[model samples]
Target: MTEFEHMLVNSFNTYIEENGIRAISYRLKQHRFTPQFLDVLVDSLNPDLYLGIECKSISVDKGANALYFSQHFTVDKNGIHQIERISNYLNKSGRRGFLAVELRLGTGHGREAYMIPWNELKKKYFDKDLKLTLQEIRSFPEIKREGKNYRVDPMEWERK
Candidate 1:
């Protein structure tokens, strides 16, 4: 995982801890299909919630408050494939999958995040560039990013 990815995981774990939830995050070293490897995995106790989080970062020099969801592959692997892998793992494990994206603006001083659920993501509902505005994501109270932490609202999370 890159430094940004590591930071994202840390932020998420911190949020979980601060919320009085027993959750821990671990980063997967290997990116594979089977056996289910992901960028970050959050294991929660008490209520028994498991989340598979995938991290992606974009530089917004133009101050665009949007997240660019990529599906095509050039140098790196296709993001959709990765998302599917995580989604499959979540399905098999009876958990939920989320995508955590970081957008850094001018001078890297401004930063925003969007946490999109697998169901909303798989629809390919975004524009031609697969971009979602920050405001659009904020409307979903259940799934949203607070600072660098991509998290599900505790109120919206179902108890098991």
Candidate 2:
């Protein structure tokens, strides 16, 4: 994982811990198809916040072609499908889940981090639960470049 991806995982784990979640956990390069390889998993008796998280990072390449959602893992069809599968697993187990993308540019050009509801995903995409519409995720402020590094301020998703 890149520094940005590491930061995202740390930020998420910190948020969960600060918010009083028990059994906060995260993994990298893990197999999500199996129950044992979830990137992040929080087990809570509280229905409101019981969630599993999948984190993805976007890679930027210099080329004549313009940047498109399809070019990024977070916005690609496969990414969506992966999230949907996780969502379905959560729903079936009476829990909630999300696919969290840690964009390199933060909310670049007006994109944001969002907690797409499982129900909406199920309706739009089949029972697979891995696809997501652009409108599903919320955007955050853009990351600012500082020297050789980029900095992203802490952001929060508005409670629904």
Candidate 3:
């Protein structure tokens, strides 16, 4: 797992334990590529609690803005693109999905993290240019990292 994935896994685990969320979540195995190109998976007896998260981290210039979600799209050997595959899986399984993106803004500047909802990403996927400026992403919930853990509250989106 990449450093961000590892940290995200730890974050989710911590949240599950502390918040008493009865869900089993883990970071997916990574060897060149994951089957679904997903970084984290959460399974639960409650349908509302089930989730699949794809983690992305990008290093940008100090003043750089915008997170071109399409820039991360990739076609697998079977000609399936990442967005289509993940979207299909979550829809068929009736699970919530999110994109956990982190923007690394140079040394000592820290990173900006956001947990973007799947529907938001889906809307952008159909667009000619899937680019969301930082100001736009700010409309979504920001993820906070306390120490080494990330504060992600899926319920905040689930109940909506």
Using lDDT as the measure, which candidate wins? 3
Question: Which ranges in model 2 have alpha carbons more than 4 Å from their true place?
Answer: 1-5, 19-21, 28-37, 60-84, 106-112, 127-159
Worst 10 residues of 3 by lDDT: 28-37
Clash pairs detected, candidate 1: none
TM-score of 3: 0.86
Whole-model Cα lDDT of every candidate shown, in order:
0.60, 0.46, 0.76
Which one wins on TM-score?
3
lDDT per residue as tens, model 1, 4-64: 5776677667677788777887787774553435577878754344777666666667655
Give the poorly placed runs of model 3, Cα more than 4 Å off.
32-34, 62-64, 158-160
Q: Give TM per candidate.
A: 0.64, 0.51, 0.86
Residue lDDT tens for model 3, 1-160: 8888788777777778897878878875556554744778888887766888888777766555777655666777898778888899888878789988888878777887888898888888777557777777667777887764677777665314
In model 1, which range of ten residues has the least summed lDDT? 71-80
Instruction: Give the clash count for each candidate.
Output: 0, 13, 0
Once model 1 is optimally superposed onto the true structure by TM-score, how far is the C-alpha of residue 55 displaced, in angstroms? 1.0
What lDDT, from 0 to 1, does candidate 1 have?
Answer: 0.60
